[model samples]
Target: MPCWYYDKKELRETPSILDGISFETERRYRKEGARFIMECGTKMGLGHNTMATGVVYFHRFYMFHSFRSFPRYVTACCCLFFAGKVEETPKKCRDIIKTARGILNDNYFYSFGEDPKEEVMTLERILLQTIKFDLQVEHPYTFLLKYAKCFKGDQQKLQKMVQMAWNFVNDSLSTVVCLQWEPEIIAVALIHLASKLSKFTVQDWEGRQPQHQRWWDMFVSDVTMEILEDICHQVLDLYQSTQKETHQSSSPPQKPPSRAESPTAVKSTNSTVIMLSSVQQQQPPPVSGNGNLQEVNNIQSIKSLAGGVPVLSSGDAPSLPQGPTPPGQSHGYHLYHAPPPPPPPVVPNVPYPTSAWGVQQTLPPPPMPPSLPPGPSGFYSTGGRQQQQRY
Candidate 1:
C-alpha cells in the first residue's frame, strides 16, 4: 500500500507547480498568516494551544494547496476556526470573522467585505477534510517547560531561561522547524538556546558521567546535542531574517513635493524674472537719428519686450544665467535660460484695400529673426529673447 504522507523533497523539486509565486512569497505569506492566527486567537480569548494548533493546520493545508489558489487570510481564519472546535474551545464562525476583520484592518493592504462567514465555513470544511479530522497537534510549549525544570541550577535563573525559551518556541512557529522537527526535539533545543543566551550552565543531576555527557544523557537517546544546535541555528536565523525585514519595512519613504509647496514653480517664476532682465540688457541704445527701419526696429524691440513672459508651470525648472562672470569670479553658477517668448500677437492696423482685379490686397507681417540655438538651459537663445517666444 502507498503511504499517504507527502514527500517534501518532491515538492521542493517541483516548486514552479505552485502557479508563478516563488517559495519566498509563500514563506512571507505563511509568516504573516501565522501572525494573524495568533492575533485572532488572542482577540477571541482563546488559549495558546488553540492558536498553535491553528497555525499547524494552516501550514499543513498549504502543503497541498498553493497560497495562490486560496487567499491566505481566509484560510488562516478557517484554520483558527477549525482548531478551536477540535481543541474543545469552539468559537462561532461569526466571532472568528469579526476578529479576522479587525486584524486585517490593522494592515492597509487587506480588507474584509460585508460578509465572510460563509466563506470561512466553506474553508473550514475543506480544512477538516484535508487533514482527515486529525486535529491532535503536539506543541513544544509543554515539552519546553518540562525540560526547563530539569535544569538544577539557580531557581531565578531557571525561571528566566524557561521564559525566554517559551518565547523562542512561539517565534519558531513562523519557521519550518516546527514542521520538520518533533516537539521534544524542538522543546529541548529551545531550552538549550535559552540557557546559552542566559549564560546558564547545566548542573549534573546524577553522579554518573562527566558534566558535559550528563546533559545529553539526561534526555532520551533520540535527542542529541547536534540536533539541538541545528534547531538553535534555525531559530536564530529566523530572528535575523525577521529583523532585516522589519528594518526595511520601517524605513521612511521618499515623498514628492505637493502642488502648494512645489519648488519647481518657485524656480520657474524666478527664471522668468531673470530672463526678462537679461533681455533688457541686450537691447541696443536708442538711435540718435530716426530712419523708418530703425524706428521699426525700435518698435520691434519694444514689442518683443512687451510680449508675454513664458508662464512656467510647476513642472519647469528655473533656468540659470549664462552672462559673463564678474571681474573677480572665474566661473558663474550654471542656470537654465528660459525659452524666447512667442512673437507679439499681431493686430491689423487697417482693413485690406480691394485691387482692380477685385481681390483684397494685404501687407504681410514683418519676418521674425531666426531664433538662436538652444543653450545649456534647454531653452532657445542664450539671451532672454527665448523667454518672450515661449509665450
Candidate 2:
C-alpha cells in the first residue's frame, strides 16, 4: 500500500472541546504532575501528532466519564492504541505496558504498583472497534526526509536540518499546542526552523555555501513561519529543562499500572520503553556467552533501530561464503543459490529507473561553476547507478 504522510480535516474529524472534566481537574490529576503524560506520550512512539490526537481522545473519553468511576490509566492505554492504529504502526500490547511502568517508577515508584496489562489488552480491543481499524495517519518524518534531500548545499548542512526537524518533532510532543495543529502544519514549521538552524550552523562553522536558495522557495509559506516560531519556543523550553530523565534511567520492573490502595484488578501498560528498561535495568542472569551475546546484541541493535522491542529483525545474519577477503570488510557482492526474477524494464522516457526495488536514484552530475561548461552534455543519462545485473 502507498504510504501516506499527512492528514486533512475531512479524514480526521476535529474533536470538539471537552467539557465534562474541567481543564482544572485534568490539570490537578496530573499536577503531582502533567509532565508524565508527555513522557508517556513520547514512549508510546505515537510521535508528536499521534500523541496530540491520543491526548485529545483521552480528554474526550474522560469528559463524559469520571476518572474516579473507573481506571484512568486504562483510558490512557486506549488513547495510545487508538492513536497508534490511526498512525499506521500499531505497538504491541506487552511492549506498551513495559514502558509506562518504567516512567512511573522514576518518580512515584513506591506509590503506584498494580498490573494493567490485562486492562491495556482489553482497552486495545475496544480502541480498535471504536476507530473501525482505520490506521495510517500522517507523520512529519517523511516530509523532513524529502525536505532535507532537496537541500543542495554541503551534505552536512542538509543533515543538520533533518536532525533539527526531528528534535522539533520530539519537542512538539511536550506542549499543549500539539493538540491545536495538524501534523503537516507542524512539519512545515519544523522544516522552517531546521532551515534557519542550518543557515546559522553553516554560518558559524564554514560560512555560507552554494545553492542554498534553490530549495528555499519550496518551503516558504505563511503557515510555515507562524507554526515554526510557536514550535521553536515550546521546544526551547524542553531543551532548557533538559528532560532526559525518561531515556537516561534504565528501564524499571514491569509493575502493574495501579495505585496499591485501589481495588481494581491491575493491568501493565506494556510499553516498549519499559521492556528496554527491564532489559537494561533489571538485567536477568546471563543466558550464556560469545554466540549468545552476539544474538542478544543483535536483538538490542534491532530494537534500538525500530525504537520498539517486538518488531525486531529475525533470522541469523547470513553466513559468509568462503573466499579470500580482509577480516572486517564484507564481500563486495552477495551470491544467492537461485536466480532471482528479473525486474520490469525501464520505460524509455521516464526519469527514473525500473528495477524490482523501483525508482533507484543515481548521483547528480558533477557541480558546474556559473562561468564554465561543466562537461559533455550527451552523456547517457541512465538516472540511476548501474548494478552488476548477473544472469
Candidate 3:
C-alpha cells in the first residue's frame, strides 16, 4: 500500500473543487454514499464485515479523486463490487450492476455507454488504482469489542454499552476523523462516549487513583485522556451539525409577494408619479383662467390627496375635479369652489307681517289716543241734531 498525506497550508488555500466544498457538504455526500453501499450489500445478503469494508473502500478512493470528476454514487457501487470479491463473498458483476441500478435508479448511474455494467467495470479499475490495491482496513468494531471485555460489570449493562459504541463506530465512518486517527484510538473514544451516555462509570469498577493513573491506562498504556477527548468531540460535533441541517431543510419555505403586491412594481409606479410631478413643476403655469390651468391646479390637489398613493397618469386629470359643468362650457373652471352660500342664514321661527314673496304688504295697526274718554254715545255736544238721533 502507498502512503497518502495532505499539506495543511495547501488545503487551507483550497486549490481544487474538492477542497473548495464545505466540510458539511462533503460529510453529507460521504454519508449518503455509505448508506447506498450498505443498501446494496444488504440486497446481496452480504455480512456486516463485507458492508463495512465496502464503505472503507469508498472513503479511501475519494481521498485521491475529486467528487466533480467522479460522482459518489458510481464510486460507491464500485467499492462494493471490489469489496465483495476481496472479502471472499464475491457477487457477479451483472448482478451488482442490476441491483445498483434498481436501488439508485438509472438517473444516478454515470455511464460511458448504455450499459451500466461497463461503467461499474471502469469505476472498479479506477478505484483499485486509487487505493493502490490496499484491501486490508482495520475497523474500530473489533477493538471496541475487545476493550468492552476489560470492564468488569453486569453482563446486560456492559452489553448495552458495547452496542452503543458499535453504533458510534459505524457513524464515525462518515467523518474524516477515522483517516486521521488509529482504529484503537477511535474505539476507545467511542467506548468513553457510550459510557457517559449509558451512565456507566469505570471509576466504580477500578476505584479512585492518583492523577497519574486513569481508566485508559489499564487497557492501552499509550493512549492518553487528551487523545480520547479529541476524538469524542469530533464525533459529537458531527451529530450536532447533522441535526442542525435536518431542522433547516425541514422548515417551511417563505411565501413571496404576488405581482400586485410586489415592491418593485410599487416603486416603479411612485417613480413615475414623481417624474410627472417634476415635469409639471418645470413647465410655466398654463395661461390663467384657461381650462388647462384649472386642470393643472386639480392635478396638484390630486397629488396632495393621493399622499404618495399612485394613481392614473397626468392625461386623466380632467376626471379628478368633481362637479357639474358650467352651462355653455363642457367643463367647470372652479378648481376650489366655495361651499354653496350657506342656506339663507337660519332666521328665528317667529311670524312677521310679510307677504308670500317676503315683502311687506301691509302696515301694523296704529295705537289709539290716550286722551279720548270711553264713550257709549256719539258726541252729544256736537249738534242738536242729536236730539232726535241716537247718541
By TM-score, the best candidate is 1
Regions more than 4 Å wrong, model 3: 4-20, 110-113, 204-212, 252-391
lDDT of 2 by residue, 1-391 (tens): 4222223332133222132443333432321122344456665655666665565555444333455543455566557766766766577665665666554432222122234555666666665555445454445666666655544556655665566567556445434434456566677676665565445232222222353342434454445454567665655444322222222222333543233221111111221121222233322112111112223322222222112111111121223346554322333222222232379334243334532212233422233323422234423223343323222
Q: In candidate 1, what are the lDDT values of residues 1-391, reduced to their tens digit?
A: 2123344564453333456666555665666678678767877889989999999888878777876567777888889888888899999887787665544432211223224676778777788878776778889998776666566778877776676667667767766676677787788788776666555677644434553464645654657677788787776665445434433333442554332221221111110011222223443222111111123232123222101111212232223335654322322122122343479456454536753223232433345667766555666654445543352
Error of 3 at 310 (Å): 54
Against the reference, the lDDT scores of all candidates come to 0.58, 0.42, 0.56
Q: Write the per-residue lDDT of candidate 3 for residues 1-391, one digit (tens) a residue.
A: 4653334343333222345665445565676677667667777898767878888888777777666567677788788888888888989877777676555432243232345567789888888888887777778888887767667777776776676677667657656665667787788898887677555666543433465375666556688777788777766665445434333333432554322121111111111111122232532122111112233332222222111111112221112235654322222211222343447454343434643212232322333423433344533332233322233
The TM-score, computed over Cα atoms with residue i paired to residue i, of candidate 2 is: 0.42
**Alpha-carbon RMSD to native, per candidate:** 30.0, 27.1, 41.3
Q: Candidate 1: minimum summed lDDT over ten consecutive residues — where?
A: 265-274
TM-score of candidate 1 against the unseen true structure: 0.59
Ranked by lDDT from best down, the candidates are 1, 3, 2
TM-score of each: 0.59, 0.42, 0.58
| Best-performing candidate as measured by lDDT | 1
Clashes of 2: 26
